[model samples]
Target: MTLTAFLKDRLVYIMTFLFLAGFAILLFVLENYRYPGLIESGTMVYIAVFAVFLLIIWLAADYVRQRHFYRQLQEATERAGERDGAAIVNNGVTHEQKLVVALLQEQNAAFLNELNQYKRQQELRNHFVLQWVHYMKTPVSVIDMQMQEVLRELPLGEEAQREAAQSIQEEAERMTRGLEQMLHTARLDKFALDLHIRRRPLHEILRSAVNSHKRLCIKHSIFPRIDGEAWVESDEKWITFVLNQLIGNSIKYSKTKPGSKNLQFRIKEQNGGAVTLEVEDEGIGILPHDLPRIFDPFFTGENGRSSGESTGMGLYLAKEVCSRLGHSLTAESVPGKGAVFTLTFKPGGIHVME
Candidate 1:
């Protein structure tokens, strides 16, 4: 049934009933009167007119009261809609309505206060963490230089010497990665990760990163290959860092027989000026469950496969860098086969890295 039709019908029935009741009462009073001189014809007419006028005045007052109540309800609804969980109480209200508004106001104030407090605490914590990481770098560098000197002076069988050098290198690299992770995590939310961005050839950055890992690649027998001729517009330093991390992880995880080359870096161009770089490995593949969480901070999944000494932040940092550079990074893996890390970079638009 239509709302208008229902309201019209109900109003008509109610008004008719009210009028009939008023007329019936008037007739009853007139009939009960036995005074021939008490109520003269002129007095009766005056009383009848006064009674009808009084009934009309009462009905008008009742209608106005009901309309005012409905208007107040509508205004309150609109005011509530404009707010964000905040509430206000006007000058006049019943006890229950006042109590509800007061409770909501208290909750809103408490929530705001708590949020402010949390932000302050987090800022202080990040400041301290960043300072600590910076201070520790000097000592870490000193230890690495000292360790290199010690290995240089030691005499041993070829096998023993190689093993010892590898151990020292792994430890030093692990320390460096940890420092980067600590610094990155502390500053992740505060500022953009890109410190320097410019127009640079992808091959130049890739070459530099690979050259830096020459010794490790040679020692592990992981042959790294690069393909594609596309140049990207982004922060060279950060992009290079991301490439190094992915390439390094692939080299570290590959299970090729000792002294066998098993790493590949392939870049391809797609439609719409998009570039794709895939770093594939012949090492231990990530499990299906662990693949999704690989890019998450502090996620070292299913053995320390990502690194010989995984700090669990290389992939996370790389993901963040790619996002800040308007790119996307994804992984595909088959357990016991290998893993492939694909980086999709497009011109113009920052990647939303989490």
Candidate 2:
């Protein structure tokens, strides 16, 4: 928009004027060779000055019209930087300038969409943290009560001491689960940075996860069975965490039954190197309406309300982790019988970094 820049851009017009004047001078020279002073030198000079004046007037008009586009564009860019995004300038007179403006408008719209989505996610994360803290207090209070009871009953009988210890252990396990959930929830956002993908044996992962819940299984009298095995390419630590959530939910819901229940881990290998692991449990199953939305954050259904124990984050985190790892987690249930949670691993899901 500066005068120097405008003159440089219109340099072609000046070159055209020079070419026209040179042709006129050559014609005058040839005519004078035949008829002396037939074309006067002063007339040629007057014509050249007139051309220069016209060129100046044309360039001035163009500069005035085009500078508005540049000025508007500069203001919009500054506003965009200040406020997450802004509307693009629309003062362009030429097609090329209008095209550039339209492209910028599209980019600005996309940026605003992304910013709004990010804000919503942060809000959800903050709400979840508050809920997690409130839920954690239950286990803490129970542990405190158990410790005070043990201290009050000094010189207790052997059976009484064992019972007190078991109660304390159970509450401690609850606290441990809550703590792990919170930690895993925090890590979920940084999942890509913290994962190493490789081939892992399905049976080993199942056994390790089952063993971790052995105490809870014993207390609830639930028998865990591993049916089959396969090799899957996945992040061991993250996949294991996912398994833990599924197993925990199974044991929790199964404990509501009368007698000993069965928890099954069925592994099936599909065509084209795909594998599926199903965690099925004999529990008070999910209602039909709630099954579809179990993976949604903080969506505790009828069973959760009745039990008064579900934070509704375990399945949500499991589904999220599965999605990011290029696997899929799904569920199905018959309200009275039990529920089955499936983890599907496709052949192409394996990602290796070299």
Candidate 3:
């Protein structure tokens, strides 16, 4: 908006005006040379002076119109810096300003949307932390109560002592699982740093995951069996964590069934060399409505209401991990029959650390 810059933009107009004045002077001189006093030099000078005066008035007027809009732009930018949030402003005095204003408005809207999304996510995390602390306190309360009883009753019976130890062990394991989940959830935000994608055996991973939940399965009378074998390109640590969540859910829901159930891991190699691992459980299944949003964060439906250990973050994190590593996680369930969570992985080095 400087005067020098504005004059440069109108340089062509100034040049055209000068060229016309020079052409008029040459024509007058040619008339006088052909016939003395045929055209007056003084009249040509007056004409040139009038044209110059008009050019000055026009240039000054144009500079004011443009400078008004630019001055507004500068003021808006300074105000934006002093403010707390995004607010881009422009006075649409020119076509260029109108277009620029529209673009800034679009960017401002997109920034607001992203900011709101982050706020919601942060709120959910804070709520989960509070809920997690409450869940952890339940086990701590039980352990403390059990110890108090033992201390009050001197010469505690060996049978009573054995039961106390068993209860304490189970509570301790529950606390450990909760702690692991919280740690894993915290690490999920920075999964790329911990990712190691390689050729991993699906069967071994399934078996290892089943073994980790053996105690819970045994307690629920659920026998887990892994079938078929296939190798896939994936990150072992994250994949294992996903399987653990799936298997844990299987056993937990199966406990409510009438009899002992079988937790099955059926690995099938589909056409086109892709591998699918299905964790099918014979437990009380998810409702049709809940199945659709099972992977949503903190979305515990009817089933979670009955389960004391349900944090609802488990499936959300599992699905997120699968997506980041270039895989897909899905669920299918019948209300009476148990649910099936299928994790599909492509062959080759198609996985990503993001």
Candidate 4:
């Protein structure tokens, strides 16, 4: 590509030419073989002049040809770097250069094909997960219904029977929640397509989420109290899901404590029309090291391991859903006091459908 480098590549030829010229000069100067007419021969001078002219012409043409090929190669490499499957520029390409370009193009095509195949496989896996969760829900629902019927038919004075029935119902509820988490986790990859955002009353969404877990809350002696009101711009369904996860965690962790359990929900309007919804629970709070990584998927910390009921996906999914909905989620906790999860909705954060 450079003149110095090009000349270095032809160093052998230059050296051979120089050696032949030196041999001819040595033969001409040798007294025993020298002809008397050699010095006076103008033909020898003409031959020397012609050979020099040819050498100059050959070097100039070679340089121009090599420079052209290298320029095209450089341009093709740049284009390939910018985009996959870019066509190599082949103008004025030598035979060897054409073969190299063809090889590079074939490799690029193969790489792109492989990348697309990987994406397809990932999509298929997610689809299968969603389908499996849906199918499993049918059987879970049937079991819950059968249990409810059995519970109702039991005699009124049978406390032991009622307790056993309630335990079964609780286990069934846990399964349902786990299934829902899986379903949502699978759908997270396609969250953009499923999102519907609008301005909705915060209290209504919170109440709906709380009611969904009413039985569990009563079982754990965890009382929920919602105070204050503000309309938030968010996806109602996703926000409810987020609330459910938070409330569920609160009830779960607080149930082990001795004191009266309380879960409080509050909404406050900030300056510039932003709203913050907080869920505070009187549960054993997060450990210092685990608090920061609580939202990481499948990262169950000390409390989760102790409870033996954490999938570690709930908070992770809640955080992701909030992010997609253009809201912020945060948490604060003291070791044994409690943990408060906050969702902040900024002004004009949610897109309202017409």
Candidate 5:
């Protein structure tokens, strides 16, 4: 829920009182006698008739007002459920609900704008952090190699020195990876990627990302398999990011069979000219409860596996980038067996821009 949303829910109680007061005043006006001249019986009959007529009008007006307010509340709730950063306007804002909505909407817009600005500022900090991480890598690598040589020359009594040096090297590598992950995650939040869109072979991009991570694949023994080439217009860099995340996730989660790694990358073209990129891994698949939030930014799973040193922004950023570039990302997992991420270049009814 948003700040304005919480405020609006509380405001509903205040609106109830206003409506009730309006009804009370209307009843009072209807009951008041206009003149004091006619016979007593005639005056009594006139008052009864007027009360009955006014009661119907009061009930009808209250019903309409309540219904309209309810609809607006529904719209606000729906808007809060979306994942994007776009402004949400409740459809229930009407003449009757204007003043209340104006207050809530203004509060919402102010908060969202500030939130966006903060994200942009954070992006700059993340960019610097990424550069620092890259710069430090060279020194870290050199130290690690030098330490290995030192360890090889050390005697049995120098075990402590060797262990400490190895630990330092490992820690340095860990910190570097963590910083890189954080930078990527921050980029996801900041929405700060330049998308150079062009028509490209989907298979080409998939293969390139797979080959780049070939070392990891070899270490993990994840096999690569391609089916067909489906042409689609999209940003290559962003698309590469998507592939890295999807395939990386597969490799990370793959369970090693007794003698082989159970991870594979397969791409297939459907009959309707749609390409499906599947990264299937026989590992700890996602739970049913976690599926709904898999694409949410910073959301991992029920376990703490997604957090720790790793920033849980890979899938989140992938979803965002895919949406902006006009593609659909879908996932299906059989718990404990495997998980598959399917990319649909053309979603159900959305036509691509040629």
Candidate 6:
């Protein structure tokens, strides 16, 4: 690489040359004592010139060979940076250098192949999760319908029977929500392909989500109140899922509170024409330490742990969905006061259908 390094590599040859030159000079000195003109001989001068010529040719050829190998190595390194191992072709370099390059290329290929295999396995697992969630949904729906019918048919005086039926219905609904959460979680991997954005009435979306959780709200003695309205552009299904998760969280955390258990949905239009939907809950609020990491997947905080039923994926999925839809989701909470989640939709983004 460097001139000094190249010369250092040929240090043995240099020492041998020096030793031979010294021996010749010593012999010449001894001969000159006997023949008096040996030191001035033209034959000795010619031999010195021929040795210098041969050394120059050998050094020049070695330099050229080493420079070529270095250049090839530089090119190969650049190609490797681009993840293109195929570009690393062996030029007539030393066998050791060529072997090293071949090994590097093989290692790169093996790594890439392993990465692709891992990706394929992950996809298959996700596919299976999606399929299983969908299949489970049918039975859940059937059970829910049957429970509703049974509840309606119960005698008016049968208080215990009604309560038992309601409990079963509530558990079934929880299972249904859990399954839906799993389905959404799986679909999150390919969210772009499944998303369909459109203009929708914010009130209608809120109402649907509220109705879905009405039974749970009643069971928890939590009253959901809706206030204000605005039109928003969003993917309805995904937004509804987000709303359900928020509402469910409110009901879950606020259920143990003594005061007015109010779960409120308030929509407001900002001065910038952005619409903000707030889900305010009088819940056992998030701890100060856990507030920042609430959106992190599978990170159940103190409240979740206490509940014994939190999967910790609800808020994470909601935040992700909002991000994909180009909306903003934020939270504010005091440890014991309450928690409020706000979803903001930008102005002019929602196509208003007449």
**Candidate 1 RMSD to the correct structure:** 7.2
Candidate 3 lDDT score at position 306:
77
| TM-scores of the candidates in the order shown | 0.69, 0.62, 0.60, 0.76, 0.54, 0.76
Give the worst 10-residue stretch by lDDT in candidate 1.
83-92
What is the per-residue lDDT of model 4 for residues 174-268, given as tens digits with 9 covering 90 to 100?
89999888888888888888888777899888888899999978877888999999998778878888888898899989999985788999999
- Distance from true position, residue 159, model 2, in Å? 2.1
Clashes of each: 3, 0, 0, 0, 0, 0
List per-candidate RMSD values in Å. Answer: 7.2, 11.4, 10.6, 5.3, 10.4, 5.5
Order the candidates by TM-score, highest first. Answer: 6, 4, 1, 2, 3, 5
State each model's CA lDDT, in order.
0.72, 0.84, 0.81, 0.84, 0.67, 0.84
Q: Report the C-alpha displacement of residue 265, candidate 3, in angstroms.
A: 0.4
lDDT of 1 by residue, 111-181 (tens): 77898899999999998998999998888888778777877777766668757766877677667767876
Worst 10 residues of 5 by lDDT: 83-92
Q: Which whole-number lDDT from 0 to 100 does residue 185 have in model 5?
A: 56
Q: Give a tens-digit lDDT track for model 5, residues 49-123.
A: 665567556655655655656655666676765533123444444575666667677777888789899978876
- Candidate 3: tens digits of C-alpha lDDT, residues 81-114: 5532234365667787788878877878887789
lDDT of 6 by residue, 1-354 (tens): 666777888889977886787688678778988988757767676767777778878887888887876666667766765666444555547788788767776787898899899999999999899899989999988988888999999989999988888888888888998998998888888987997887899999899889988877876788889999889888899999999899888988998887568888899989988999999998889998999999999999988999897888899999988877878799999888899999989765534322
Which ten-residue region of model 6 has the weakest summed lDDT?
345-354
Report the CA-based lDDT of candidate 5 relative to the real structure.
0.67
Clashing pairs in 2: none
lDDT of 6: 0.84
Error of 3 at 24 (Å): 30
lDDT of 4 at 129: 88
lDDT per residue, candidate 2, 1-354, as tens digits? 578876887788779887987788778778877998787879777877887788778878988889888778767767866653346486578999988878877887888799899989986885687578667767677876777677566565667777777778677777777877886787676677788988889899889999999988998999999999899989998898899999999998999898999999999999888999999999999999998899999998989989998998989999998888889999999997999999999886846221
